[model samples]
Target chain A: MWYHIDPSSGTPIYRQLVEQVQQAVASGVLRAGDRLPSVRDLAVELAVNPNTVAKAYQELERAGVIETPRGKGSFIADRDHTVTEEERLRQFIEAADKLVADAYRLRIGSERAAALFAERLAEAERRRSGE
Target chain B: MSDVAIRLAGLTKRYGEKVALSAVEMVVPTGSFSALLGPNGAGKTTLIRCLTGMIRPDGGAGTVLGVPVGPGYPPTALKSRIGYVAQTQALPERMTAQELIGLCRGVQPRWNDAIVKRYLDLFALPMKQVVRQMSGGMKSQLALTLVMGGQPELLILDEPTMGLDPKNRHQYLQVLLADSIETGCTVLLSSHDLHQIERLADRATILVGGRVAVSGAIDDLKADEKRVRIAGAVEEAVVLGVEGVRRAVKEPGGWLLFVSGASEGLVERLRGLPGVTGVQVFSQSLEEIFLSYA
Candidate 1:
């Protein structure tokens, strides 16, 4: 319910919810035992169709991100959902493709791009180590 | 669910020399939220009137909720089950919202008082205020509330949020969507607000010159229609020769090729073309698609 769904964005509403729930799970914000808002409650809160919310919940259930029990309600599934290697590679490739395209446009040398990548990695590592 | 809420077959109408409708045909599915999009004088109002039995078409025939529609006008039974909140709707100036609600309630056998109370509470509209004293937005919302209170099977709203501010519009649409979800109301809302349509509607029918220009699931249309920017020395003619290409514009660096509901592999095919050094495929938003035919 805390998540926001931008109606103007090209992305579908149900997909937005799916991604938000996944992100929250990945960020440790939504624990395995946390209960998601009921379909009606979330629909009213989000100002979206209950069918859209229901579809999102159904997708999340199919993906093992949540569980819906009969006579009760839906809750986060008790499973460790990790990002697949294929998905990570796809993300990295998409980022790299865009970077390469921009570099080609700006005539940036490969050496400069490599050095920039390394510098950013070191900065991220330093932050991770509390530096 | 497959049964249509409204259907028109080669429906045509003319006012003097002007053609209000030209072979206008469309289908609004039961329990589905559909956006009827068109510019001014695009026969949107004419079509609505024909469906509501308020006006007789010059040619063709149609049906609303399985009731036949024609020149003589629709049956009273069919009219009662459908709710239509016209853009030009007017309320009695001296009547209070409460008083008017009472008057309207007397005519509707299936009217729900709870819905009236709930909508009044949501909009915070004073029940005692005369309609003429209300703002345009307030009057629009009041009319919609009155129509919706009847809990009709099919609801047609003609730009019901035209005068509402962004916040008010969002709230009003939210309430409407919630009601639709709860009651499975079949809604056909004609509005130029593409943002609202994109958010709330799953399907649409774009009208151009009183004819259906585009109609289908919104997502499929988005996927099919894309602006492909490819940087290469490839011949524009050859690329335009490719199937599904709607428009091809030659830019300094490349060509912006618009593919209309093209297959997914078309972009990949363009990427594989010789001299295609850089390619960018831009998926169109609903507004862009609407503008293309509008």
Candidate 2:
């Protein structure tokens, strides 16, 4: 998997990398047990400092989103067990805030926006289950 | 080992009546990748030269890797451990890359031919081609290879990526980054590419008018300096009234406020002001921060 980082952004590079991995996991783009690129490899790939990549990986490991056994590379942790209900809800709310604000700007009514979200959620569930 | 790799205090230098460096104070922590940034004639090269022991500062003091470096202080004890790559070097024009590598290895206490060969192969630099026949990019890579082969504990790069294209530039930085990671080597690189530096450096010291304008961890620097957009017809005086707001510029619908020392309360204060319909805070990029000082 490829991770993209915006060097010019005000967000710290490590935070950006951490957020990317979280987003990828939330979207099912990265499944549990999927191996993450080693810290050195990812840093070289992004042309960033290796310590920045290590910091991101360290944060992810602390959050239980990824795990690295000795002599083994990092892998996405089993999300269902690793993430608490409260943590999952917080992540959902964070994603929903953007959609909600965007809908309000576009003048879409709450009912229609909620219906659209439900449809998308059902579609995502269907796709995941089918796989 | 001391935590500091380089320290400068009141380091002053003069070049024929022109002041190149004036009482400059800067520090590079051990194992940190640092970028020394400034415009042309901003004393960046002068400072690098001072740190590398190429020249002595007329006044003040400098130390590299725990050894005092300045006038009257010989660099013999420190020179072997530090790698200095200038923007241009007078490589013997007639020598092939292989021969130059052999020559550099013979003088250095530590030389890793494998490291040189690895980069040579990675960059596809011709080992048999003499320096006179190599292109600018190839020669640049060769210079870097020679420096890295010595396994210096400190790498001082002065615009090391001046001539390479984007792909080559990335490759060159990778080698440096990897070496730093594996060996815990400290790097003090001076470059004009803030975009690349932003990604590669953990700390940055922006010099202006031979003075240290801003020097700190990049994250803290970005956090402290911010731009805020306040909606509606806000008066400049009203925005300036806020404690942290430094300058207020008129915008189409409202005003843009340049703020320094932006604490959490600063944003809240901006939102509470009258006539403020909305307030959005943005962290300034490294380039913007440098321009502010310039």
Query: lDDT of all predictions, in order shown?
Result: 0.83, 0.87
lDDT digits (tens) for residues B138-248 of candidate 1: 998899889988889999999999889988987898888878878888999899888778777878888888888888767677767777888989997878877777778
Candidate 2 local lDDT, B1-294, one digit each (tens): 789999989999998889999899999999999999998889999898888777789998878888887555645767778998898866899999989988998998889888888888899988899999988888889998999999898999999998788888888898888888888889999999998999999899999988888898887889898888899877788889899888888888999888889998998998888888998988778888887777
lDDT for each residue of candidate 1 in A1-131, tens digit (9 for 90 to 100): 67787766667778889989987875567878898888877876766666678889988887778888895788887764544567657867997999999988999899999899899878765754555
Measured with C-alpha atoms, the lDDT of residue B292 in candidate 2 is 70
The TM-score that candidate 2 achieves is: 0.91
lDDT of 1 at A116: 90
After TM-score superposition, what is the CA distance of residue B113 in candidate 2 from its true location, in Å?
Answer: 2.1
Say which candidate scores most in TM-score.
2
Name the weakest run of 10 consecutive residues (lDDT summed) in model 1 chain B: B216-225
In model 2, residue pairs whose N, Cα or C atoms come closer than 3 Å (at least 3 residues apart or on different chains), thus clashing, are none
Best by DockQ: 2
